[model samples]
Target chain A: MDLRDKYGLLIDDMADMRATVRIQLADGGLEKCDQARNVKEAVQKLSLRRYDLIVCDYNLGQGADGQQLLELLRRRQILPLTTAFLIITGETSYEQVATAAEYAPDDYLLKPFTADALRTRLTRILEKKEALAPLYRHLGPKGDPVQALAVCDELLAQGSRYSLDILRHKGELLQTLNRSQEALALYEGVLQQRATPWATVGKARVLAAGGDDTAAKEQLAGALKAYPNYLAAYDSLAAILEKTDTEAAQAVMEQSLAVAPTTQRQRRVGALALENEDYVRAEEAFKRAVEKDRTGFFKSHDDYAGLARSYSAQGKVQEALATVKDMSQYFAASPALTARQAAVESQVYAKAGNAEAAKAALQKALQTRQGGDLDPATQLEIAQACFTSGSAEQAKDIIRNLAEDHHENDQVLAEAQKVFARAGLGDEGGVFLDATRKRMVKLNNDAVALAKAGELDQAIAMLTEAADRLRNNCQVAINAALALLMNIHRKGMDTSALARAHHYILQARHANPEHPRLEEVASFYRKVAPPGTLILDDE
Target chain B: MDTLLATVIHDAKNGLATLGAWLEQARAQTPSPALEEACRQAQRINTQLVELLALHRGSEGTLRLAIADHDLADFVDDLKAEWLAPPQSTITVSWPADAGRIGAWAFDAYQVKLVLLDVLRNALRHARTTVALRLAVEPGGGIRFTVQDDGPGFPVAHSATMHDQGSGLGLSFARLIAREHRTPNGKHGDIEMKNAPQGGALFSLILP
Candidate 1:
């Protein structure tokens, strides 16, 4: 709700809206209308009463804007499909956002519209919605997907007037279900009719999902060239760029942010710019991310940490330290996150001329590290801090732990090597790293031997222990997951064993999202679980 | 300069909305012709403001169309309901039954309404008794809208290009918008103004 003291325009706008709506309803022999001045009041009224139409002004002075409010309602399914939302905007810029948004209002009305214009638009939209009701029943915001597809086929069979609308909905639902080929055919049907940006972008997305990146990129380029402000096109295009070209990905991410500064998109922009070592842009983007995420929907503690890292990259040690403190205020202290924060503090202190403070911060980080299985990323972070603070011996232990667990990850191994090289222990590091790798290999092989001997429970126990030790090591974690899967197969799908398999798969998937072994694990999951069951990675 | 003009127009439009609301309240309470007239004038002010804003946007290239297929008969009836008040002036809309059963056509409904509303308001202002609007689908899939008033025709010696100083801007705005309503095939709409042989100002818009 708005806390703004200036209520003049708001009061006037409410009066106008009420009068116009009241009269229009009166003409149609209907009554019982109320006008709300802010988002909170509107939401409350909406919940308590069933209204056929809402003429919401885009700007609500503060808190959520009308688009955000509409998004929240639609996502939460608080607004029924029959409730027509007509967004009213004072500036044309809102149209860009409306066009870009995935869940837009029924229509947009420019401000200073007469009561007659409002009536005309309201009447037309109601009629249109009435005409599209059958499709809405099958494929609206809270529609049943299977029924929606069935209805789409039925509508197509009957040559329904809303054939194009149903076609787009069926395409999107099919895309969501990973049925890219069928979705592609539908999108192609739309493209045959018109070069609409949504259809163009959908074709690109389907192609990308089908692993035809070259064609996908060309389709995306066409979509972007046709409609520069197509937000989803920019995002899908950026995801493609992320795999092959970081700089271009940064550009596409920036363009998307220009249209809608979603926290997730801004975070991606910050991360991609940081990958390019564009520290200034990274800092700006992270700042925007942190600011926009203040009310916290898709926000996380990492956004603040990202800003601190950007500050540390720029040698703004004081700012970095303050940012970590700010992070503490937002996220409650936890053992693992406390260690990560201390590690960040250590990095900031090491950048300044405070060796003693840096050493103390390392002590704080290590004290927390004693409590839990530190993920390889946290280990690497703490190790970097240790090396920066003149404690190479302490840093070597964390690096060795990471190198042992992550030996199969080229990206992690390279990053670890750089840490060792920077600390002037390049020659000594190879011996330590090799010893750790050999030990981890032996441990893995011993578990396999136990399994081969039909000591399945022993094998599961050994891998469970290894999982705690390796934590964020994808290969080792996947092996642990495999052991659990074997137990599920031997024990006839016991609930406890299934839960363990599910847990390890989540950590493994998060550690390396695109792990090649995912196909193998997915096959095992299919054998052990029901068909159509959602897994962590799939979700 | 444009910004200042827009701000003034915005304020005027908003003020008219408020006045319209107050007039509606007054009419609901007392049901007087004077309050009804006030409401009508407020609506007229809003319509004029809208035309002026469109004229401004036309100067820039920012006035985008919101195209949709509208039933020609339904649209004409709605337009009549919107403009015609009781007993002051009468408006009648008709279409030929021989026009190949025209169901619907794609056009910017709001823009078309604004353009035609300006013409109808001008006709209402001058007509002695009745103004008529007719819709006809041309043989080539184009549509024609004709608005004629049974008022004193355009001053006898008035040239076509020279708009009457009073109704000049509204008619000009209507012409600008009619031309803007081009079909997807790139065929443009056209506007014509004349003094009908029956002695009244006639305006027609043809869209392809």
Candidate 2:
């Protein structure tokens, strides 16, 4: 709780306000303080050095606010859990800061607060952070949730003052580790004690993860009614509804936007509206997503792509092409952007009845892909272009490969289905994607069964080939590593097999760091590997 | 018209806040009773502007409370820190000792704090020597905050309306904010005002 040793960062656009706050912070016993005037400087300072506390003004004066900066830092993992972030805002922006869906600051102080008030908030947040430091040590991007769970148990047993916070983190960790039943119980127990929005949404998420979508939807609906400002409930409900009812999902997203108009939510609403074929609404939402952030840091390629498609759908092909051109100017040159622009151009041209020009653009997009792998979004855009340019087989091949590579990624698979839907093949796309999913699941099951039946050599041969080809398929990589480890356990330790197992485990981790089976495979490696070998620690 | 009113109130409130910050800085550099009073008045105007904006939103049916979990002890501590005693006065304020035991409750801390501060300031003006703020769990569920002063009770004729009080806007704003803190099970918070058996006015804000 001593502020003398803590390092603080003060961010504000106004020089006078910064000086005033700097004096107040000094009055609060914080001597080692740094200042940043904008998001760029703030991020630069944060990346270079770690601070114990950050006090940021809400209005940063450049189309960037503290909330957006916090989101960026949190998403990029530049801000650690140990650092306390506080937002200073006027009454006008308090609701926006309060209703932040994700990446909320530790606390916020309204403007016109005195030095004592500021110190009290800083002290309280610092004290809580100190209490939960042990758990946070293992809760970073590269940290181990398995070990973090152990810390949670220890803290709970000791009756820590932050029991509710610890419980929240524990439930999230349980869900991440795929322990749905236990997570369900934890949430239910918390709900019985008192009604909390997070507990309600957490229970619904567990139900959804366990494939009880009906119950999950019902729970989320009730939670939303109770806590209308709870953005997480709206997000979860919209995600569940997206698969069954795009219109309803779009409505839910609109309600959330009414509560808090985040650019990410705008993109989501645009995507859902596009799926619902409400082209005008899609264009408006995507336009907001593109133009709201004049800083150009938060806008993604998907925003422009969504805007272009919405325009094309409404027979505004010229506007769509113009939007694509603006996208290239907004962002620096990159292969992904080139591929995305060309692919979207193909779709626009096809919609305009220029089949020859569409085919030429599709060839350009395909040539760009030959240089290297693009992001999944760009790849799916190319697949959609393929379908529009009279290349059905090529489109199917592209989607099939992507589906196999990201077999366990629901978001990517959903994007693939959207591509098909845009291509006027919704029903066929669902069936085709379902088959690809089943095929991938069966491949893993058969390999595991063969290994269990003592056909280790056959399992190894089957799994390694699949794992090597589908590098992004986490399940395949995990199984391949498991088979090789099992072989070494039955036979003597073959150095080559051990090395390959290590490689596959690391590959699996790279594919999905939070995969439930990762820790299990890692522990298995630690147990079977010889001493003095280079062991991969779960840092 | 509503948008214009809200925008003007917001800008005025922000201007007052900056003025208050400057006053505070000046007071810190060169302490004086006049600077201190100016700072307090600036803060008072800022709070009133905030209340007016909330009232505007309430009338327009756009008043949304950003309710979330807040530790009761920290909330009380913050209130105590901000509740400055009137200049040249000797009235003292006391808070509940059991706030730490209550843990956290879900409410809009910013708005609730303003409501309580308004009530506390009013009580300070009317109290003879002391004001007390108490916190306890409501009978069925939820939490209650009570602010009572030791002075002449509310006038018998205006006990219900309290129109003799300044503007009567604070009471209405308090009631609106209380009613907004509702639960999923069709339960809503309420505000109650009555003369305490001991001496003075007693106000209870219950949140579910």
Candidate 3:
């Protein structure tokens, strides 16, 4: 069907720009079109009718920007695959836009365009869409990436000007499929034919995904040598250096920010600086992020917290306190943020030897935790602050609870260990950890011994008791249950046992992903589980 | 009318030439794709041509920013529709994610469309499949558009004496129009060209 016959919506803040675009579309034979001045008007129009295409400005006074509008539309499943959404932008730096691409849009129109040009681009996009309609349809409601790749392969074979796009899509699909080698090879093949930053970045992504930071950095370096302004290259290079070299990573982030200083990138740089303990740089970067986000959608309480963190670390206690108050004014809606500010305030008060004020701040923090789950990381920090203020018992209880709740989390465990060490309770913490581990292992070992002795009922009872006692030891619980179930429910694969195992494994995975033993347990459950069913064996 | 049209055209062309010259200088002093020159060439041509064309229409009292129900993707597609790159030269443009057919944007839609097309044409003529376009709308209030090619970007040496050689008028035109549409917040739209790290020229446009 022709696009002119399809209804569409056009949204722009400027009347002139809107009129200009409207005429251009008429010239291109698009007959049914409506216009809105901003996102609010656009939303009204959107609710009233379905449009085949949407032309929107990035900035619309109040409500949501074009990206957020699109995200909201997608979130609500309001826009369909057949519907086209285009964003109008006037940004010089791609960094901000790069983050937007993570959400995905159909097309972008830079300002100062002509009618003829718009016609040509729109026609091209329409034809390409028609070509990939089958794939689009099959990918279903929100878009299944794997199926999209398979469909792209068919379109690629059809041969067109968009083969590069198809190839890139295929590479992305392959990457998603965990076929990193194939994805890398595909990206490399594209690079061999022509040096494109996208292809180079694609290769770097593969390398990074493959756990080869050095190769990814090398590829990024080569690309940068050829095309220094390719922003993706800088981002990829920075990501690669992030883990191994904090100084280098900060330098890369700084360089990237110098080229295109977006609020998000600035925040990232600040957060990284804080991580690297570069308090001065962190303070500067966080301030810039706060300044930038103050007037844009990038506004986030995280930036405020980051600024507070930087100031606090630098011993600018009053400045930090003031920053939190400013944050409170804008972030009154976020209880967690209030809690964070309180935690920071308590630190400041404690440092100043104002015990009463510190206590009050801590109490405020506890109040914030009353109705909801505090983020574990934040809770850990508050607990640490409490311990430093001679509330060692409270700290001990907090760590103990956290350790038990996330028994499989090595990272959290290590962090908890450090916290304990700092609180002068390292030996006690270590002993607690050792005892917990021994208890879990002994539970499993005892069940195994009972099962081997031909006392199936006793073995099952022992496992049941063990599972009850070590409720948070997901891995052990799954194994012990499986062993008993293997002896008792050998009729035709124990569905109950499999279900329970899967639940424990899933929770364990959430707590400590990519564990070496996870896949083995999964396979075991798969071998003896019912088809198309899941069990929540988590305690 | 002719004088005004010519003046606008001249300004755009000169802007492109100057940009090309600067790029050449940058290329000679630096290494590789000489991106600044290439970007100048792309922006000048795209922006200037639109300005001149608009002016030409204005003189005749027909100057208007067209808005209608057009397939935005089709417009971008038409700019560089030919996919089969010549044996020795190639131009590859893909919509790795949906071939960019799910959305459309309105502005001086036609001018921006041509800016993308003109860029592709230049890449095809000067380089080959080295051309790629990435179009998206940011959560902020603007659109992000990118065009790139895998061929070695603008020749650095020739760029220095831009008016002396194949001085790029296309990029200049694009940039001029973009600048005109620039917002008072110093956020006017901009067109930038550079070399792709893998090996090509890239032109990026940010419009608000």
Candidate 4:
């Protein structure tokens, strides 16, 4: 209950972090606190007893993350209603968590926090948590979202000071219940009162999920203009752009990194440049990433491969060979890294006109990927190696499978197309490409035709089928999504349809780069979609 | 990091402030020859801190020096009064034996003060008896200041040079301060330390 009683918790993983926090907390008269190092420890401790305040880290190395742990505790009713949970994270990837709505913490804190700042944030969260306990208790575990929304609405209507937070919670709840349109409207209502960046980002999320990436980009861009140093906005904008404009995407990432350069962003930008064949930039970015975050768990032979590729491109064959050979000197014997080194070796050998050496290198890389513990990106890179080594047929199959599987994803589609084009399977690529285009068009027209003929069920059926078949096709996705939106609009004009249509439309635009209708449809989506579902303008 | 540098300067200044406080406290509590020596050591540290801060300011182009005209006789009189107040020391004034040459002149007041302070310190250190100062005008439209002490004179060839000195930065600092004034040939002003013909150390400043 008191600040002095909070620091005695036996959390080992973040002892340094705890010490730092303790120093600051001591300034605030807080001590004797309980702590959790990981999900298992946290859960085990929670099972025995409930702490008044639970300060948790989002990433716990392995198993359940902070959010997942929160969900588990909340779902099992092991966590006391009186206990407050605070999440901390180095990353700004809050939206990337698939079940974000399911395990929302009481409040989250960003890193590099000072004592005074942390104290201020914790004090506010404590105040709010106390105020909302009654409603939280009434809702209980496995609470009804509609009922929760009503409670939040009642609080907002009463003009509570916690209205913004309540509105956010309400929207998140709506998002969970698949009532994104209503949630979007609520978010927009909050935005109209003030230019809140998080609310704007929330709206962009709805737009992105509803399939309107252009709208999402626009919203994110607007937010970024106001909050240039806000890393989350840049990250969201970068995510949208990564599907279409690699150069613009890289620039946004670089800008973000310049403000608060992270190891992950550096690695991501480096890998993207490598894919784009901008080897020198990739190498430099990777080198900076390596030098900056020595403890980053995401380390790979990619840095070496990147440098190797850069050197090969620069016509320094010997240096390229030397760099790859030297990676083994420092790192442990990693088969995946060996594969990466082999891929680079093959490229170097091929550049040097040594076919036999290239083949041998390619075989080693193939062997590495076959060891079955490679990360997804590494697997993609290995697939790329296969294509580069004149195995077009094998590359075609790999890409086609990945494309069909992540068919609804714009970034994945672009990546798939790039791989196919790289393998010289342009005609086969065209068939898949043209078929996707024709199929999307037909699917859209079929759903529209079904809706116009007063066959609503058939229209819904047509859309559902289209959704299943060309899950990644933006046109079909948007059309099918639009049908559902129309259906929902007819049933009292709810905003959920708008959210869905927007998300699907964005996806479509991403899949078909330079599509003339992208901007037009996006503008239309903005008009019909719920206010919170509109992403900020890019330009 | 810029904040870190600022903090360092702040800490150093605070150290000097604390030393001053301790010196004052000691002066009241105990009076001994050894304690006087301790006080002088503390004063040296304080002076070093002041010079360091000035150097910092000079590097930043923020060191302020007011330029004004003052009679050489009045300037020497004011310095003599300050010297007489504390540890009294004998002083003598020498000129071209004429009044017209040792007239009023204008230069940076702070640099002039620093030059006089350095010469006075050197005089106090080595002059056991009397120190002499000479003021004159060069053949051109320039002014010259010369300080000579009655202690051992400096070595010939090396002592006349600018940078080569046992004290390291003080001589260089005096010369650097002198460069702010310009000569008639458009070169900056110059300062040099050497063995006076009579005895002891001699410091000279030539100003345009």
lDDT tens digits, residues A1-539, model 2? 77999999999999999999999999999999999999999999999999999999999996778988899998888998999999999767776567654667899898767887789889999999999999999786666888999999999999887888899999999998888999999999977656678888999999998989999998998887768888999999988888788899999999999888888889999988898889999999999999985455677999999999999999998899999999867888999999999999999999999999999999999999889867799999999999999899999998999999998998999999988887789899999999999999999999999999999999999999999988888999999999999999999889889999999999998888867678788889988899987688764
- TM-score values for chain B across all models: 0.82, 0.91, 0.55, 0.74
Question: Could you tell me the TM-score of candidate 2?
Answer: 0.94
The residue-by-residue lDDT of candidate 2 on B61-145, one tens digit each, is 7777776777888889888877777778899889998897877777888889999999888888889999899999886888899
Please tell me how candidate 3 rates in CAPRI terms: incorrect
Q: Lowest lDDT 10-mer window, candidate 1 chain A?
A: A1-10
Question: Chain B, model 3, TM-score against the native?
Answer: 0.55
TM-score of each: 0.61, 0.94, 0.58, 0.46
Error of 4 at A180 (Å): 5.7
Docking class of 2: acceptable
lDDT of model 4 at position A490: 67
User: What is every candidate's C-alpha DockQ against the true complex, given to 2 decimals?
Assistant: 0.10, 0.47, 0.04, 0.01
| Number of the top-ranking candidate, with DockQ as the measure | 2
Cα shift from native, residue A407, model 3 (Å): 9.6
Q: Which of the two, 1 or 4, has more lDDT?
A: 1
For residues A1-539, could you state the per-residue lDDT of candidate 4 as single tens digits? 34565533333366687677667667876766666677667767777765767777666664446666676677567877667677766412332332123345755555545565556556656666776765575344334455676788788788665555666677777776567788789878765443444677788888887889988888887766544455677778887887678788888888776655555678778867776778788878877866654433345666767667777776889988988897787678877777778877887887788878988988888777767545434555666767777786665555554554345455666655665665666567768755654555565677788898877667877776665555445556556656665676566455555556656775665555333335455555555555555562542
In model 3, where do residues sit more than 4 Å from their true spots?
A4-7, A23-35, A39-52, A58-83, A88-105, A110-117, A133-163, A332-334, A380-539, B1-208
| Model 3, residue A315: C-alpha shift (Å) | 2.7
Model 2 lDDT, residue A348, Cα: 97
The sequence of per-residue lDDT tens digits that candidate 3 reaches over residues A93-199 is 12245332434577666554667666655655566667767766644333456567778877877764566666767787677667898898898786554334567
iRMSD, per candidate, in listed order: 6.6, 1.9, 16.3, 29.3
Instruction: Please rank every candidate by DockQ, starting with the best.
Output: 2, 1, 3, 4
Cα RMSD to native, each candidate? 9.6, 2.6, 14.0, 20.5
* Candidate 4 local lDDT, residue A458: 78
